[model samples]
Target: MLPFYSLLLIATWLVPKYCLVQLNEPFLYISATTFKFVLTSTLFLTKLKMKMSKFVCFITKKLQNLSIFVNPFWIQICYFISVSSVGFLVLKVLKPRNKSFRPNDFDVFFMSVSATTVSSMSTLEMEVFSDTQLTVLTILMVLGGEVFVSVLGLHWLNSKFKKQETQNKVIDPLVVSVEDLRYKSSIRYLSYVVWAYFLVIHIVGSTMISIYMSLVSSARNVLKNKGLHLVTFSMFTTVSTFTNCGFIPTNENMIVFSKHSGLLLILIPQILLGNTLYPPCLRFLIWVLWRLTKREELNYLLRMNFSDGIGYNHLLPFLHSCLLVVTVFGFIVIQFILFCCMEWNSEALKGLNCYQKLVAALFQSVNSRHTGESVVDLSIISPAILVLYVVMMYLPPYTTFLPRKNDEQSLRSNEKMKKRREKLVENLLFSQLSYLAIFIILICITEREKLREDPLNFTVLNIVIEVISAYGNVGFTTGYSCERQLKHDGYCKDAWYGFSGRWSNEGKLILILVMFFGRLKKFNMEGGKGWKLM
Candidate 1:
């Protein structure tokens, strides 16, 4: 913790000093804040690449000797790069790919981060990133809600290019066929269908919330400046939860006129947004049952699946998604209750209105799985709430978005051919489950004393929490940023010394990692062998 703060402070001072020194070179000159920002971004990208570098090289070498062109690691890397870039591209271009398809891992990762982080929470737009950058990112995130669909579109482009006799063919041949194309296309369409449920409910709810806030108690005076604030707020939130950025432009000190409008609009959308994203568990359930029952209809739908992948044909996706939903919401509800009963419960509601409190709870749950929106003052937030966040931060995405092959010989099953197939599946599944639990427990036990002492120590618990936070792209904090305020006088003084957001060097790095991890496929984090999600 001490090192963390010290490094941050040093960066704050050093970057500006360096920038000032470089000022004579007009082309190279930039603000200290911007320079620090780039430096932080570089640190994050470097670390992320380093984290996967070894694993990727190992997989590549193994595949090289065996003639598996375009190894799984390449797919994963491509998935990350594509998901991020394509989503930005599509929003502007209005390309051919629709929502019904499931994309490869890169596209999926893009969609996952786009959807989960809810980039709509971002206030910056044509004003901040240039009209093109804003428009591209927004559209990609808004329309491209699922990583799977993006993967589909990218693969299709590659396929068409391949046929056109392009130079490179990165996606393996198995992923190149028309059958795969149709299946994936169908999946993306279904995602839009899923969006329909979220859209309508979101529109109706957000509209009502906006109207209420616009006309409600103590709103008229303060809200006079930004009349369309409510409408834009609603739409942005729709984009946010739909995408999951959880960024709120208005908070306690700012946007008084739009206070309730901001909170209600921001929080409510996530409740439905989390449900709209990929339905991995549902697909999984369908996969297992489809295998055992040999149901003709189920098989046909999957065969005629509307998109690139067979996502809707199985119940596994639905089940897994339900688990994810429960895991996130369950933790939030439990924490909310615990907070309500705590001694400082009243303090939790210190200056917030009812809508704000509701928004805070919902935001907490939603961020548990995706992007974090820490609207409530963290200083007042009890340790219990932080614990809940830590717990959610460590829990893997309840649903494994990767396509599982339950065929005669899965990576897990082939090893135990001597054993019954069912026995092998059970053994592998349980063993991994056991491994996860033990590994987590060991990390906790090893770091328990540190956690107790500082609770904010960056140990295994912090690493685990960081990983999970990265998984959903939800940014969690002990008392980081504007999410909480100056209960500790020193922190308040630190704020006046410089802009908190500008000063946040390490925080920026953590955010980039979270954003990258935020887009990573759920199962990939679990260490499944020979299973390239893309």
Candidate 2:
């Protein structure tokens, strides 16, 4: 660790200096931070891809030979931890030189882990970081989230694609089996299109945001003479937004762009599409469209042979997609109705017109689903709404979002499948509630003294919101920036909303553990759900 840390320090110190000089030249192609982000993202992605490939091969060969079983839940857990550890170390090595305020080592590590987990909790203000460090953080967000895992799935999918291609060349042209067709369709629709889809969205989204920023002098000036193109802001915003990692270029977050409807339009779609169940949803959507259009070429490409009856296996992805859609839809509707019924005239939504209020409701509802970007200060919301948020975050529906095909060919009974699904849901809910209890308890015990000293700021409600945010990995806060509090020898007089920036080291450690556990549990439980669905 010593040698590795030394090498990282040397690189971090030297690389920026060299790149700064190069970037000063008029003809240079890219900024240093962007270059670092690209280089690091590529490196991590390649390593992860190779590891996944080797693991898959090992499972197919060695594990099968030994007649031993290894659960995907454990495999996913290991993958998450390994990638996150590397990501944290990289952030530590590439620590920012631009001192907004000097951050302790734990702050950087916490941010790195949060980004890797795709949980966007911030322990420090984001605006203080150097561009190079911020770019690294953005890359970590993308790589740490669904994008990296999806790419690994694509690596396995490549072999599946080749196998299907070979099968397509068969002279008999027998009807494709349900499983074969599902794989082929998923590969064609998801594997092939997902990257292109993201690229197109990024280009369009960044353009929209940059254009909006240009119209605002405050945002435009931030990019001025910084060797950052107008598009750079867009790129960073696009990636972070789509990954649902709640990082913002500014410390104030989306509050600065609260009135910007164009930005909202771009963000909402990205958040919706980035939901954990999107891949499976996409597969089902394409399948439906092919059926509606009766496009022979599409059907041929997807290798869809519908001669056999559509089995429950074929419908699982579609069912999962439908459930996700309903879940999000139901949540938004319910939240909006409550907002109207309860806090219609509250300061949070007071000045806004009816239309703006509705839009605000929609945004907050979507955001509550762990998207983390906030347009409104959460502190002012009624206790009822806050309670609703706690519930939404603690038990996000994405925990059971992706379903895989079952291997119960021997006992093809609908009754058995129904029972299995019920059991799976029971286990998921139980685990989530249990974890939530543990997090809340730990936070309470750790912050007892702090709560006593500053009851107003560290009230029970504030503690609950903060704990849920940490456990849910959502970064929404009432504004308790604790960096100042922790720095001073005495308690700070400021009423900055949100959790402790000034918390004891022990308190911060509890939040860190909760955040990590939340992220790790998400992947493990979600993957386990998919396995059970199969």
Candidate 3:
């Protein structure tokens, strides 16, 4: 502990000098003040070291006791809430690009929640947001991304394991299990792999995007006309795509650059790596590590059975990993064929050559799964294609094809009796679909007036799509059109916002809850499984 304080004192002294060189004068002044305070406190504490150590130990024990009653699930919920709240305040204080376009408090708060949850459901147009606000949204997306959150969880679990191991060594010097050691090491290694994956993808994606924008005249001109910098657009697009948040700096999302097939192709891998294809990519990385390192922990990660292995869910068995890749691309292929066939000559895909159309179709197919960047206006697309998109959005990111094996059946049979006993006390509550149904009903109730007044634009299918998109955390929407209104009133005006933008405040709040539910959906993967339809 004395050594810890010594290191802290050294850091306090060095950090202010570093900040003075790198940061602005204000930050340097703040750091200097902090350094002085810490220095004074350290000198005083050294004089009263014996008494201060006892006080620190007492506080640490009290904190440990308090942490025992804190649930991890609640901690996650609190994290989102706190981030969203801070984002909301920041957005509220920051000025938008448009001087007259001040977003309402609720809309700002809604955007914060959407960004924090990576929902990307927006009520305001993207162009109104300043570059600073866009940067904030990018930060929220990165912090709220699945990979980032999982890595944080892994780090926390690793620390907990180390703490427990230290206690075990104190209790009995030779009592540590080899399996526990391997599991802990595997977690730490996995954390490193994920961190590398996150950084490498962002760096590569941003670099490629920047180069493409610089080399391509059309894309560069589009950013220029919108008053966006090359680096800002590249970084924002990469972060948004890799997080699968679907937030584009432009109002049209990916539509304006649809003809830039090369740009579309570049973003496709980023979309996949961040969401649906994450599991297969992760398993492949682990497999490669095992092949190269021949380490026991890598082998444990690669060979462990999903059901009884290390608690990490992304590390799938080899067979399942292969199946996941097949299933993911199989669905994409189906959607691609259907999209090209049906939309080749449609107005939705007008003005594109055969090559561009093909690339755009494939891009849209990949995005429909979870990444919701769209090249075509989905409203103009064939209803059949939209229905297929809905189905794709409803499926979870890791949905895969797995054939039941005889060995797995035998293993399940061994647990059948225990499952049956557990089922006796299991509560039959709302399933995932049940919850979605409730959200849909609530939104319908809240938007009933508009549903009747603008049935054409506010169709039940559009409502379902919006709700499902929010629940899936995919930002796809059919979009609202003033011309499509049943009766064109004088107040009708077209805006580049999602379908949910037309909904009342209550409906937006309901969608907010849906986004929260969707973000934390892994906890409910087994929901409604306790009920037997037969």
Candidate 4:
């Protein structure tokens, strides 16, 4: 009965999205599923909570034993929205008037995996390739970003609401310090600003790519012919990749002279976003506003930390973000220098004047660290570069995942993050190279096809992609080949992604083994009471 109740509730939210897609745009229903889930879930959750205290109490208590289940409820809800939408979308494509199904599991899994990792692979690339693919990727990447930010926002909302509930009276402020995402008060206004910032960056990045296209296209002056899809593609690609959606639209086809700034723009933002720099920026803006308005209370509010008496942590989070960007940047730079000096064929680079070589350097600089979208041929790169790639791919950039002890007990998880960066970078300097050497040899020798396949098997290549995408959750497939050719019974993804980019089956098994190790990783030294004597 309990299982049945849960299933029914889930189905109620998703049934409309499935039917809606089947009714209209039936061909692209899976593509519509994620958003539709968001829409329907919002509606269902609203109605479920409306004057339904009994149902609420039933759910709240029944799930109390499973705190972890409830903890990630939002993630589950978001994922449910994402997966149901994809199912509807696939059905629309197969268009089963009677019910013969083509179970394209990889396509939908890739969609969910890509969204979770903020990657850019699409069934379209494996099917009828079009620029609209970028738009789909863009939406997924934004949802990924939204999930991260919303979780951060919820941390605030839960605390505030808990306090109010205890007092048994609402102390409402005209400008709320925090609210649910839908509530949109002045405090939540900052979230809107964050959204706008990302949108503008997406547009600017796309526009730059478009300009590059305009310069290189033979039909340069013809605005009517260039098409909005390209602009849309470029913008979405920029934000998608920046937000860590590793999908692409304009592949090897590029406007040689338009400007390579789009590539640079896309690359920089990954570092920026990966570092999660928005909170500090928001804090800065609040400080400026307080000073400008001459509001002492505003200044006091700014000074407050999540827990009492813990003062402002100005440099810790910034430094954490800096180390993350720097480590990735530095590692990728070494990879380029080594690859070019040791592996790159002399003939290709030899003919270049300093300027052309310089541009190629710029290209190399942007793509290697953040994404696997090498403008040049990946198959041709030196074995060492490929080996370097495997090493870089394993870095999971999360503030919460690493060691936590000795860390400051601040709500800003970034402090512990900074400490972990120091440890990983330091370990890499000493022991990681040998360990990486052994791992690389295993990959190259054991995974023969990853190295030797011409147009790599979509299934096999997905393993390579999954390994890389897991760390940063960026999904990009180099233009090695279209996925349809690599499909084995339409389930190449089963073959392609080896355990869902290290977030899946074998990866979890490996983690379970590692958990037995006596000590878990710890963070920055607390000095008895970090930033406090409390």
Candidate 5:
């Protein structure tokens, strides 16, 4: 048992290091291979079997005792906070690209939280970050992404099931129910599917982006001029887009590459696959598996129940999944039409030709939903379009247009609805809007001077948009401009950052909490139901 435990710890440390290193690093490969060989050799030692069994039982009993406090919501919150803290420390130690620029401690911490939550809210320019800082951000975004987090959750569930099975085997094998077995099998299958989805999209997306940048001299030159490596830019953009984080390597975001319609086209699918279109895509994948393998577990996974037969919420019914696809596209089309009509002759699209404008409009429309990657200055866009973008950002990623069920189906679902309502605690008294209003008010107080002096730039509408964007975990903002200030002072200087970058320390702190709240908003989806106005 001692030998096995020691080897397990060593393996865990070596495996992660090995994975992070390049293939050209043969020393790590040899170390990993040697560790694996030694671990396997020790596993076959018959003398340790009895001790190992005893240790397993001891650990299982301890875990069972401690399981009462293991809430998934708290686990997720802690995960984000822990990752953010680590990122902050790493960024603090790493030197910035610009030797003269030294960001405030609060801003560095804010950037860490923003990246960890995939919110993309910035208080500093993107180019100021060294390549190491960018890599750290890339890692944070990938780890914080919805798809990657879901995969981690699936892995946790699978391990929990395995532990339960082990305990049942040791205590009473017959206690394991048929339903439990089916559920466990389904979780394992879903875990595999999610992992495949995450890996395949990243691999394909990065590869395509790399190839496009190579062929397109204009795109390649943008990175070269900025002193960015082609591979780093490709991987960073791919991760950011797929995660819907919107934190591009360049300060201007997608605006710098607005003319690269091909690049925008390449990213559109990646954005959808990672966010709004995920549920439908997952359902389709399971359906395809059901078709190929004709497996009962996959079929059970595709069930129309809200619980999805396996306790996974994302796997929607066939009808609901189809409706979600239509609803998402419908929103995109509406945004595209309005943006094109309003901004067609505006300065935002002035330099671009008609085709470029169309592609840029489509890209902006898609990003307005959650990605937050913009092709044009959002501040310069029409107020009407900005309002539309705000609404789009406020809506949840899985917002779908589900048709009313027939009488019989409605009757059948009533019991489930009642059960769900019964689980909602009265303590969750505030709605999502209520929280947003409170944040907006706090921000206004913090930025009260700015609001008064620069009414045009710091209008209530702009404040509302910024607050909603933070609460929605979308990074869209009516960015600050010294030009828009009513009375321009010598102190007023424009910085290449988001609107929130111009916010005071107190306001920035408030938005940091908003980003955290938004990231964990799934846990409180039914919150504020107890305080319904109706």
Candidate 6:
């Protein structure tokens, strides 16, 4: 009876969406179902709270006990699964606004996965989505993109409390070591600070984007419900930039905002700080400011070391700061210089003035590293530029190197640290390279017939770019067509001419796997036990 009721309630909530797609007389059925379930659930929950139903109370208690297994790993996995599932369900429920060119179930699921993974790949046109659908995509981005250190910290806290004995008051082995305790403490503090940090960054970035959008008369006219549209667009840009989830609301993406320097200004720093590099860069900034102020009290706070009053733990963060800054900036400068020298007169940059070209180069460099957004068309770029992008994306996140402990005991500890760092880098490289390799192999095998049929339409470079995009989770494509032959007959001309929409089901499945691995590998690399402080 309980199981039946629960399933009924769930179905009732979903009926409206399903009805819109399937049934002609949906409203009557949906409204009746909704009312019945709502009334029944209200009565049952109310009665259970008043101790009128022992069965309901038992079920509630069981759910409470089961929640103990909810850790960060499972939470992340669940988030991915939930987003995909909800997206699949939504697509199944909603009827297409246009009768002619309705997206199949798989197409919806693929786009959902792309959005949830932040891969920025899309088979269907984004410009056609209703406001409700965009809202759903935005929510998925927020959930999937942002790092949930807070949830991780809370789980740690729960584990700690659960381990305490009422009589013996024994400390668990997990938290017994000083280093372990310190790590846990750091996580707790980080979890607390991370939300506030995200809020501040988003507010600033969104404000700038909003201002830029308002200043542009054309943009204002195109986007109706000015205030709401600005906020929605700002949220999309903010999350997309900061989380490195590069799902642009508009089809044109950064190209539309090319003239808006104010928007680019916001995007540049957000991309730099939003990627894995942000933490170290932030620590460096704080340290520099503290040094200039020369405030001894603030030094302790900034260092994030409450127990060690000597400020000895600053070494790791300092080193991290230096390494990230030099590596990222160096790569960007080299790439920008190369772009100017090699592709100065390319079609992508032909319309742009010198300043705009410089900005475009900078944007591409930053975006290629992780964020995946692009102001210029990647398809038209020279091989040199494409190679640069591949290299940048292939390199692990700038913050991949784990700094050695400040106070090491012996040569063994130092050697252990070195080996751990090496292993981390190795894992990162292997993770990305393996994905790229598999994707390439699959493309060749699955797309062999198609390639032979239309050699001009499907080139090796097109496939390589797609694989790189998937493996890096960068989402930039050479606008490859989905079918072997150009079905549109050159009707829709965009830089993404040979984009994901044209890929076969088998090819898309392979890329989906690539995106999953690209995202999952990061979580696996970060979660493993190699980072334990000595």
**lDDT-based ranking:** 3, 5, 6, 2, 1, 4
In model 6, where is the ten-residue run with the lowest total lDDT?
Answer: 306-315
Deviation of model 2 at 131, angstroms = 1.1
105-214 in candidate 1: lDDT tens per residue?
A: 33323333433344322211112222333334444454334432343333333334434333224445454677555444544444433434434444554454454544
Q: Of the candidates numbered 2 and 4, which has the greater lDDT value?
A: 2
Candidate 2 wrong stretches, greater than 4 Å = 1-70, 95-97, 157-189, 216-229, 276-281, 288-316, 349-355, 399-430, 481-500, 522-534
- Tens-place lDDT per residue, model 6, 233-277, is 666777778878787777677776665555676789988777756
User: In candidate 5, which residue pairs get closer than 3 Å at backbone N, Cα or C atoms, i.e. clash?
Assistant: none
Cα lDDT over the full model 6: 0.63
Find the candidate with the highest lDDT and give its number: 3
The CA root-mean-square deviation of candidate 1, after full C-alpha superposition on the true structure, stands at 16.9
Better lDDT candidate (1, 5): 5
lDDT of 5 at 380: 85
**How does each model score on lDDT?**
0.43, 0.61, 0.82, 0.42, 0.81, 0.63
Tell me how far the alpha carbon of residue 114 in candidate 6 is from the true structure, in angstroms, after superposition. 1.3
TM-score of each: 0.50, 0.69, 0.84, 0.53, 0.84, 0.70
Which should have the higher TM-score, number 2 or number 6?
6
Q: What's the residue-level lDDT of 239 in candidate 6? A: 78
Q: What is the C-alpha RMSD of each candidate to the true structure, in Å?
A: 16.9, 9.4, 9.4, 13.1, 8.7, 12.0
lDDT of residue 261 for candidate 4 = 40
| Clash counts for the predictions, in order | 65, 13, 0, 16, 0, 10
> What is the model-wide C-alpha lDDT for candidate 3?
0.82
- Per-residue lDDT value at 467 in model 3: 91
Candidate 5 clash figure, as a count:
0
Give the Cα error of residue 319 in candidate 4, in Å. 4.1
Q: State which candidate, 3 or 6, has the greater TM-score.
A: 3
Candidate 2, run of 10 with poorest lDDT: 306-315
